[model samples]
Target: MKWGLLGGTFDPIHMGHLRCAEEIREIFELNRIVFIPASKSPHKLDAEITSFYHRAQMVRLAIEGNPSFSFSDVEHQRAGKSYSIETVEYFLNKYLKSIEIYFILGQDAFQAIQTWKEWQKLLLLCNFAVLTRPGYENMGLSGALPEEFSAQFTYDEKTSGYRGPTGHHIYFRKVTFLDISSSDIRSRVRHGKSITYLTPDPVRHYIQKNNLFQMD
Candidate 1:
């Protein structure tokens, strides 16, 4: 089975995230896409994020209508910060060799690959589908892949992406470019502003019901 794994803090899963996942699933013909909310992010330690239980619930509410979309608490179950390499390793072990895992991320995030922990090994573990963010011109890998690992991939004209030495592929996908963000939603909610169209109805309801993001 072809599976796509998209992990993030998902402080509150919004429409932008859901749109990208849906597009990636359709583009890659993925059997399913799992939205894994991080227990704690290594990079965002200084930032105050929503609780894992709330984030997980929001993710569940965001993708409730789609059968192909599902949520996982893999990171929450594990201790300490969630790393992509560990998540990939866990999936590899669980599925054996029967599953093809595609790691879905944004172009901006992909550009900072060099900063990630064991990024080189993480790249070779699964196919990467980097979605283009709004206001980012040029959707290809020419300026995307870091210089350190640039030698590892050779552009394949047919595939319109790069193929790694270890058989992993990096695809630059163009998805629905929504400018929405969780930070903005939080700010809006804190200021008593309506976030009606920013996220799914269920998620919005969940946040309001739980009084999330409101200032103390």
Candidate 2:
């Protein structure tokens, strides 16, 4: 079975995250989309993030009606900062040997992967599906990646992506990315504005019931 792993802080699980995942899943023909919320992001070390429990709850609520979407709390159970490579390794071991793992992320995150922990190994460990915005899509990987790393991949005519040394592919495909963001939703709440359509109703109600995102 082919599965897609989408990891983020998911501070509130907004529409942009959902739409991007849906488009990627359709393009890649993924059997399932696993939402992995980070317990602590190394990239956002200095930023104030929501609690793992609450974030995970928001993710679960956001994907409640969809059978194809599921939640994985592997990062919360693991120690240390929530690194993508470690999370990929965990799923590689959990699933069947024949399973094809796809690590999904936005173009911005995929471009800055060199700064991530064990990024080189992560690229070789699983296939990457990078989401690009409609008007700002950059279809080439040669410039996004550093020279030493980009040299490891060659363009594939069949997939319109680069085939990595490990046989996995790095794809940059345009998806319907909405302007919504978790941070923006939080800001709207802090300003006493409505976030009804920004996120799922369940998550919006949960945030209200729990009195979350009211503080800075």
Candidate 3:
């Protein structure tokens, strides 16, 4: 089976994330998409974030209706900061090559690939489905990695993706643009504003019930 892995802080999952995952799943013919909430992000260590339990619960509520959407707390079970490489390796070992893993992320996030730990190896480990905004050009692994490093991948006309040394491909495709964001939703809630239409009704209710994002 084809699986898509979407990892994020997911302080609160919103429509944009859900929509992007849905489109990516359809485009790549993925059987299901797993939403993994980071227990602690290395990049956002200094920043304030919601608790892992709460974030995971919010994700569960957000994707409850979608049978193809599932949630995982693998990071929470591990110690220390959450890293994408470890998560990818975990899935690889568990599935034992039975399933094709596609690491789904946004173009902006992909552009900052160098900042991630073991980024070079992670790219070659599994297929990458970088979600670009509508109308963006398909410049896979070019602007994201160094010239010498990216030269390893060759374009395959059949797959329409760049094939890495490990036989995994990096596929770049445009997804429907949704202007909504979790940060904006948090800001609205902190200021006593409505977040309706920004996220699913269940997620909105969950945030309110848990009193998340409210000023102390």
**Residue pairs in collision within model 2:** none
User: How displaced is residue 33 in candidate 2, in Å?
Assistant: 0.4
In the range 1-216, model 2's lDDT, one tens digit per residue, is: 999999998998988899888888899999999999999899898998888999999999999999999999999999889999889998888774478998998888877888999888999998999888655459477657778878889999999888999999998888886888888899999989999889989999999999998964
The C-alpha RMSD in Å for every predicted model, in order, reads 1.4, 1.4, 1.3
**Candidate No. with top lDDT:** 3
By the lDDT metric, which is better: model 1 or model 2?
A: 1
Model 1 lDDT, full chain set: 0.89
Worst 10 residues of 3 by lDDT: 133-142
Question: For each candidate, what is the lDDT?
Answer: 0.89, 0.89, 0.92
Candidate 3's clash total is 0
- Descending-TM-score candidate ranking: 3, 2, 1
Model 1 residue 60 CA deviation in Å = 0.7
TM-score, each model? 0.95, 0.96, 0.96
What does the lDDT read for residue 168 in candidate 1?
A: 78
Q: Choose 2 or 3, whichever is better by TM-score.
A: 3
Q: Is candidate 1 or candidate 3 better by lDDT?
A: 3
Residues 35-97, model 3: lDDT tens digits = 999998998999889998888988998999899999999999999999999999999899898
